[model samples]
Target chain A: MAVGIKDLAREAGLSVATVSKALNEYADVSEETRQRVREIARLLNYQPNVTARGLQSRRTNMVGLVIPTMEPHLSDDPYFLDLLAGIADEAAEHEFALLLTRCAPGPKERTCYQKIVRGRRVDGLIVVRTRSQDQRVAYLLEEGFPFVTFGRTDQGLDFPFVDVDGTQGVYDATRYLIGLGHRRIGFIAAPEGLMFGFHRQEGFRKAMEEAGLAMEPGLLARGDLTLQSGDVAMGQLLDRDPPPTAVVACNDLMALGAMRAARKRGLWVGRDLAVVGFDDTHVAAHSRPSLTTVSQPIYDIGILLCRMLLQTLQGKPLEVRQILLRPALVIRESSGGTIS
Target chain B: MAVGIKDLAREAGLSVATVSKALNEYADVSEETRQRVREIARLLNYQPNVTARGLQSRRTNMVGLVIPTMEPHLSDDPYFLDLLAGIADEAAEHEFALLLTRCAPGPKERTCYQKIVRGRRVDGLIVVRTRSQDQRVAYLLEEGFPFVTFGRTDQGLDFPFVDVDGTQGVYDATRYLIGLGHRRIGFIAAPEGLMFGFHRQEGFRKAMEEAGLAMEPGLLARGDLTLQSGDVAMGQLLDRDPPPTAVVACNDLMALGAMRAARKRGLWVGRDLAVVGFDDTHVAAHSRPSLTTVSQPIYDIGILLCRMLLQTLQGKPLEVRQILLRPALVIRESSGGTIS
Candidate 1:
């Protein structure tokens, strides 16, 4: 049987109530006595039942994160891992654990959120992949639960979030392509409903309009943010009567996919065609003809999100409730800049 | 305020005790009353107090996993991400959530184990990176807690585990190197204390011994399983008199690092110095000179470990208490075999 407060009390020569007070660090208990009781408890390996204690304190000291079940893509994507490492490290530093749940997209996702929130499995939650509608955000707001999102929602809800500036990042990439004298640039966008997708699309349109270039509807394609999807989308764009000289993908995975499609068509990346991607993940640096992409500090975003949520859970006033981090474009060979 | 059993009872026009029994699915409660109570509770968003319920049931339905704080490297490595995706997916399928903690190595790691185990924060745990004399394993064994390890311990304690066959993996890589007529080969090994490291080293020695080759002390170097460490270790091996013509790293990260070191010395990877790495991670295939490495189903291992732990937690007898999966050798450009 597991050792308990009674065991500590017996070993410390104290009453059960006194041992409990000492363990709980009640101000009424003398420091010396508390120390002695704690030492005894440590020696006995006495473990206080956290579940029982949570009933009284209403705090589990855990932060919940629900990831979408992206399957094969998730296993290969280093983005989420970087974010998780950051959150796990920060949570550990703050004496908190991270609770992870994987939910499929759609109705099941809402059920997953309700199970965690209503069950009170964690003190707070960190939500990722915010959408235009974002029922998850709506539910959390209605329930008045503490949460921080990795992206913003179209609903314009007032909530704590840390999001990368997708618009500016994509706009800069598009401007770079335009500067390279590419009048017709293909764009592989994230699927509809994702707020980031909308921002990225807006950036592309703004860049084209500012450059006095008419965007051919045939040059725009949507992908499900997968390498395969990107390949198919790029293939469609390449089939245009007058194909684009360059392409911009919403994410590195899609960008790499576009490169693959270019290669399949006997086009050498960085020479025959220029490709740019967003989210400079680990694969972006190691991929053949290394990707030129927009870099976001994904790991740091996770750390800041956790810190914000923990502060909120502690009922502390946040200096900044929402954070919008600007992403920088990283130049590499894939953008055709290395061709001399 | 959060909806309670009383509120659910009031809405359903039933006594609080009857509502509670109905929600708990007691056979004593009629099916019609149970359905009415459940529908009312769902409409009102009545979340049962899991904390209070846990006090009665002694089950949290959570599985704990503690990763080492190997920052910088952790973010770049896809191996852990794949494993995590597997475990997270399986846990969700089984209606369990994963509790994650990041702990530094050494004495503090033990403290982390104590906190999670003693606090009863999870129904079971999944331990990774097992050591030869793992105190965490010993403590879990002593506590009689439900846990399954990703690797084995050398303490001769019979426990449930799912591990890759490191010895066989390295043995095959070594034999393949010998087949390529490389008499002198350097081995970049994992740090001490890790059980996998020991087994991998043993495989290297066995292969060299069987080949009637004399092992040179200067050719052997140890790395802390990071790319930087692998680079440093490879540098030391190259500094030796008549440095080995080929090198085998314990992991893909170190192997890639060793390749970097070779290039810095103005040696062509596939022509001058053959390099091999274990853990055919995603980067292994994408690296400039694709790595010839040992492939383990890391993600599948994660899934199996979770299934085993959940089975144990549910008091189900395992078909196999211990699993040792054989890793395959995937030959690529790095090992000099692709030079035509």
Candidate 2:
């Protein structure tokens, strides 16, 4: 038979209540008695029933993370995996297990949130890919659930989140290309529904306007953050009457795709046409000729998100609720150019 | 206040015990009463307390998956992510949430397992990367825990598992290289501790013996299943007195790495040195010259593992206790050769 609190209490010559208190670290138990009870519990290899303890003290010691992706193959996007690694690392360090789930990208996702949070499956949740009017965020807020997000939304709510400065990253990349004597620059942008997508496009527009460059409609193409989409978008730009001398893709996978398109058109990447990508994924570093891109501290953001959630869970006051990290432009062979 | 069983019973004009029986679909409850109870529960937005229900039935409706990797950043391995996607898809489909943990790869891992399985955190577990004489399999077997593995171990114990035929994968890759009239072949192997490592090595040796080709010691190099490791291992092979014209890496990442190494030496892949890899990941298809690899139905195996574990969880009879799926060779430009 599995060892229970009753067995530990019997062995330690203490009441079952006393044994439970000692195990849960209740302040009423004396130190000496607590130590004795713990020793006996360890000797018997007793596993404290988390469920029973949760009933008494409303802490499940679990965190929830729901990925809102219709893509069954989330592996294609390295960004999600990196964020997961960061979250997993911090969750482990803080002694919290991560409960993961995926919701189909549509309206019925609120039911998923209610099932886990209202069902008391997890104490807190981690939300990612925040839309402009994220119902998940609103629901969590109204329900007074402890949660954190990887991106900030335009929902006009105060919440804890860790977001990378995508605007500055794209703006800097465009400025770098402008400084390299590239007046005609093309942008392969992310879908407009995403908050980051809007920020990045705005950054590109601001940079082009500041540099006194003409922002032609043909120079801008839309991509859904996939390699194939990048390829098609880049092709659209190249087919213009005056193709862009330099190109900037929203993410590394798309950036690599742009390079392939340039290569197929017999243009040398560094000399004839320059390319830049965001997110600086591992593949970007290993790509032939290498990709110059903006690097987001993805793993660090994950750790920070988890830490912030833990502080809220522990009822500790946070010094800062909103944490924004800067992304840096990594120079490599793909954007090679001498002084203008 | 959250709706409870008592509230449901009162609203349905039934006793608490009768409501519970109807909700659980007990034989004592009539079909009309069961439907009425369910409709009333839904109307009230009543979420069954999974924890309290689990206390009575000892079923959490959650499965566990722990990745045993020393590398804190598991994003580098696309294979792991694919497996996760597969597991997540099936878990969501079955109305079961997944509990994920990362055991710091060492002796401390056993404590992590005990905490989750023994503490009743999950109903079953899914094990991957089976090692020779795996203590995990042994422990789960001894405890009679409902678990399934992605790979088999050398423990000589009968258990439910969903495994890809790695031996056949490598054997066919080697045979395909041999068919190209390339006798000087190099092999990049995974770490020796993994059961798949042994099986893949045996396949290489058997294929070479059948082809009457010399298995030179200098032509064999070991890698830890990373792109950089593949590059270093491939470099070692190329440093041989007469470098092999054809190379086979245990995985696609390493194969790409080996191709990088060959390219650095000014050798054109598919022309000078043919390369083949296993586990045809997304990158393999997008690589510059494209990679030839053995494709394991990773997503399918993930779904299969969850199905098997669910069967064990529900106490249902399994049609086939042990499932071994075939791995097919996907030919691409990387292994382009006729009479090399």
Candidate 3:
């Protein structure tokens, strides 16, 4: 029903093989032939010449991105969005395409990933959100697939990865809180098991520990990285006897939530609580009495990841395999109060 | 660095072709041979299967998606993200791989698209944000490529498409305002050229025209669908001799901006200036004086689009090539005011 190679050949007055070679940019074909074929192809909107695909293998040159399902927080997190924008920008520049797939945990999620991997689809993978022992990373490792992760692994697998210096970012966030004369500053950390939660928790603890501050065990409260979680965690923290004056939320959503909850309790956010957050998300600015937070170089990270992966694909030696960088602290209205 | 098929064949005491056929689920291979070949391949984590790919052609079994660059209005529009999630879910279910690409306008955008189409990137394409008389669709039409679109097309091409009942949605949105006895309702519409803007305007026009209401030319205004644009439009509308009591923004971000500008002008949003927004994005719910908006089945639209494309690629005819889905109006605090 549609035009075939024979039709194209008859129309162009060239042999089918010559048409195929010229259309495919084969070195054997003359530039004039290639140009003529390309012009016709463009004019006709002719499909790719797949006959020589055996030689070229029809490289899609498209990368596949798989974000874990459980962390809707990553999507809600402005910081993560910035990182994604960076990756998108980099991919756009390199003339390469990217496929983004987000899967949650379930039989459905596992089956979906299995089908893609089993069908020999996708050239490489980019994964975010790593648990201390994440199954997805482990599976990719065992499958001997090429992948770059945004989170670190303690499992000792030598996979290529680029991650922010969350420990240092938290360190900066904590030090700022302390500078406001907040000695009993509490840390609203993520669930202690995940890599980010652990790193941020460590940073807060290390800063407090180095400062020779003594605190009760209940000062460190955990929340899943959500605004709701922050609200709930703040409730629990406030319930304790003699609650801390200042709190550092490991992520921005929690900070926003904490601010809301504090306001509800007639507590002035910056003056009464002196709260700080990480991942200076977009809402961090719009929130009443805007949030003081940590700003990660997300766009730069995406560009760096792209350059690293491209170089590795092109067989160029790289100076660094694992990149760990720091985030800057952005002062806003949320943490403006001087600690009593 | 990796085990070759020849080496595996020698180890398994079979011909290279026989080993490959067994590993690949070929009918000629016995079950016993297949099991043993699979075990060996698993052990090797064998990379580079493109050699055997040379033996056959057709049906790379991949799906393609093209979206515009991540502008704040589009990327942060929860509607698109929700739609993407739905598409990803359905694509995953069919075991189909996705080729995601962001189209920028100009040489880079053209090359990015050209590489995907001419490079034999995917089995089909799914285009988001369809414009009236879109060139991309025209190009695909001229190329005879298989593709699906998530928005309406003015090109009159016979292609599969899934679209929200945008006309109906806007019509209903305006009718709700009319029900509240608001006569001088304003529409803060998108740039006049897009198909989406056209449909939304049609809906609004239809409702007013059907109700025998004469719309003043000054009552209709256009914005680029940014928060800033919304702010500017709101300011301009407020400066009119007799300002509109109610205004509907075609997109949620613009509505938020309108609300902000209203607050800036010291007008109570829900009480003094009733506002409504389309595309019940996440920000709409979180916005101060939460917005009244229409909820398009964004995620469901994605799933339906992907399913239709998958069916088209599988030799199944698209039974319903054009799908105009319904939208639900989420009645919130914004438009619940009493009219004089």
Which regions of candidate 1 deviate over 4 angstroms? A10-15, A337-340, B240-243, B337-340
Model 3, C-alpha of A268: deviation from truth (Å):
5.4
Tell me how far the alpha carbon of residue B53 in candidate 1 is from the true structure, in angstroms, after superposition: 1.4
TM-score of chain A of each: 0.96, 0.94, 0.90
Ranking by DockQ: 1, 2, 3
Estimate, for each residue in B93-155, the C-alpha lDDT of model 2 and write its tens digit: 999988888886579888888777668889999999899888888888877888999898997
Ranking by lDDT: 1, 2, 3
Q: For candidate 3, write residues A120-199 as lDDT tens digits.
A: 44556677777787777787777776667888977877777888788998888888788778888877888755788788
Candidate 3: how large is its RMSD? 4.1
User: Which residue pairs does candidate 2 place in steric collision?
Assistant: none
Q: Pick the candidate with the highest DockQ.
A: 1
Worst 10 residues of 1 chain B by lDDT: B68-77
lDDT of 1 by residue, B273-333 (tens): 8999998887787666789999999888889999999999999989999999999999998
TM-score of chain B of 2: 0.94
lDDT of 2 at B330: 98
Model 2, C-alpha of A203: deviation from truth (Å): 1.2
